[model samples]
Target: MDQVVTQKPHELLAETLSTKMAAVNTLIQTRMASEHAPRIPEVTAHLVNAGGKRLRPMLTLAAAKLCGYAGEDDVKLAATVEFIHTATLLHDDVVDESGQRRGRPTANLLWDNKSSVLVGDYLFSRSFQLMVETGSLQVLDILANASATIAEGEVLQMTAASDLKTDESIYLQVVRGKTAALFSAATQVGGVIAEASDTQVQALYDYGDALGIAFQIADDLLDYQGDAKTTGKNVGDDFRERKLTLPVIKAVAQATDEERAFWTRTIEKGRQEDGDLEQALALMAKYQTLEATRADALVWAAKAKDALNVLPETAIRTMLVDLADYVVARLH
Candidate 1:
């Protein structure tokens, strides 16, 4: 994918991150086999072996190393993070009834929903086992709370579906619970495992939370503005599904009486027709919700950088700051 900021990844940071990610990759390859059933292995490997950016695991590794950790548990934690992310992807595809992901057929689309869901469960259990191997109750608590938050976020989004009245406060909470919780926990636990000072620990947690928030907001905004080839999914998929995202919520608040009536009839009532796509695009542009959401993303990204002040300025910390900017810079 084309990164939108900082002239692609810096060479030094890319090499440093790459070395850490290699260890994570090895751990995943060695541990992600199925013991109970071979079919589980087949299904798990389909997505696990598929090329992903490995951002989550890299976050874990980067946080650990930046906090001066050089132990084997970090490897286990890195693998745990990747497993959790992959399991979420499986469950997400099932929930969204998605056909494509990362330019490939989704597991639920390639196989049946049964394979996707059950294999997702298997991965979840395996991730738990891997986390337990770390032997840190705090790590377990952090990830466990994150998993619950993620589920709550999904339920909130489902309940809020097609509701035109969903406000910015509710939207932020949903994005935080669904996306930022895991990112924060992954990085926070890395600091916890490294036994960083409380101040350092809080800084890492805040940094991850802000980074995740910015990233999700950017993702939602780019759904309308980005190239389909770059984003690896259909634009207007959120609109077609009648999901009320940040851009739509902001646009609704800014709509005129006639525009509000149109939204109520189409978006709220789920009465999309053949030309709904063009109509939604025009409405979004008319309200400038895209620009508003992007501003929110940049705000959180700046907060992410601010949180990094407690830590000494290392290359990794600088890289993390740059990466945070990259997430919000997508809209530009």
Candidate 2:
């Protein structure tokens, strides 16, 4: 009989950080509540309970503890980070017209798009309230800037997505804006609230920035390679939606005129038909873009691990290092 692996490092991190995470969870529940509008909590609860990894908020809490913080503000910051993330998900579903997330019906599918948008706005307001309680001007500035960057990234994607002209630089800008901005903010604010040294704070920011890049790249790669049951997403979902993620971007860069026409019709003109997805996958495989994209993700993961060298070593730090590895490990 084969022996079972008891837990992963993140599971252990969660166990070690259980007490603080409980406080963060309580704060999230309390803040997500709305006195006048019952619909706010209803929609919020649906998504909040959807079993995400809570990795962004966990980054905030882990950074604070790693920096030797013992105050209550880390909990508030963690909850605030979660609110910001949840708000983005709600808004993203509306934008994507997505029907499912975390293997369940998205809030927009269950409720009207207007309700999802309004509740997402309410959560953003709640996040601001929590940030003000932290009372750090720098922290507020970081989060505020991250929020703006996220919106900008989404808008950029709207214009650039499906356009073969979008190079890797534009793709990276969108990734940094949509994903890494919040991640960097989460870790940076944790160090700020802890009064960590400038070098340590910068190190945390770098770690998160690289980790977020790796994570999003892995996700994009998985769209072509992953099982729908495991990924909780339909394979070819990006293809069907005509979103030009990294692997497709690489394939596009090397396309023949014949291949380019296929992309133009399906992605640019949105006239997808039977075998389009299979043909698209064939182009990616022919270009070896999926392998190239995986290599890129591993590079960012390595960068994240390297960034951690600036911080003092601790159990939490080790777990964070492992967490970075695990983010890309999903690709294998």
Candidate 3:
């Protein structure tokens, strides 16, 4: 008997959208190339070829198809979305001083930071070029605003990540800026290109926003309890990096004076000692903050699913709803 393989939601979406994704990949390669600067392609390819889910670009394609689009502009916008996402990863790795990404060495590590930053800027320019080719002022406006929001979020994180006063509201703002902005824009642009009704476009935006929030919250939660090999990150990396993730922020909110001192010394003062990770885990366990964070993620995932009620029921829509669940399901 043949063995049956169970496909994940993203895998299913990829299979369904394989042809469009191929075009997007081709465009990405053609645009990433630079005649004068060979290093640009090298650095860009290093990160681009790395095993990523391609979820953001896929969202664009899916939204376009869902809105009954027949034109080729969806492909261009899909490629644009991907370029923007890849550029952000390159810059983010440098900002975080990260050694690994997507279970591989980061581009900044393989090449120099200068190479990474310059190549990232090159990709951003390429993304704009692709978007301009679409000739839609609305699409350009959406993506441009998303780019600005991403930068603003990064700057906010720089100031807020180590600060003890970073609360849930501030954290939500950062998540929306750094993560959800692109997601919502990707979907929103898809609808815009298809000339979808204003209501449908808003629905797509809402779905993407909630899904992105769920995705990030799940990622932050995983940093505390996930398998390092699976997640491509060591457990407690967020704690070690002094990032004020949702779980840590929740724990800080409920901390006693002694626990507050621990957060102050480790996160605020950057004086993480040996066994501190264990103590941090113990504190989170004591407060059940991880569980609380997981609950929040689930809530967002639910909202993402609910947002799809406005769209027509189809396989793509179902997959998108399932994709939202799968992001948080990693916790299980």
Number of the predicted model whose lDDT against the real structure is largest: 3
Better of 1 and 2 by TM-score: 2
- For model 3 the local lDDT of residue 43 reads 89
Q: What's the lDDT for all of these models? A: 0.84, 0.93, 0.94
lDDT of 3 by residue, 20-82 (tens): 999999999899999999999888888888878899999999999999998999999999989
Question: Where is model 2 poorest over a 10-residue stretch in terms of lDDT?
Answer: 1-10
Candidate 3 residue 6 Cα shift, in angstroms, is 1.5
lDDT of 2 by residue, 183-240 (tens): 9999999999999999999999999999999999999999999999999988999999
Clashing pairs for model 3 are none
Give candidate 3's TM-score: 0.98
Question: What does candidate 1's lDDT look like per residue over 1-332, in tens digits?
Answer: 24434244434454676766777777777676766677777777888877776777777877888899988787788788888888888888899898888888989998889999998888888889989998999999999898889888888987776788888999888988889988898889889899999999899999989998998999888888888988886898888888888988998898899888888888788887898878888998887888888898999999999999988789789888888877776688
Clashes of each: 0, 0, 0
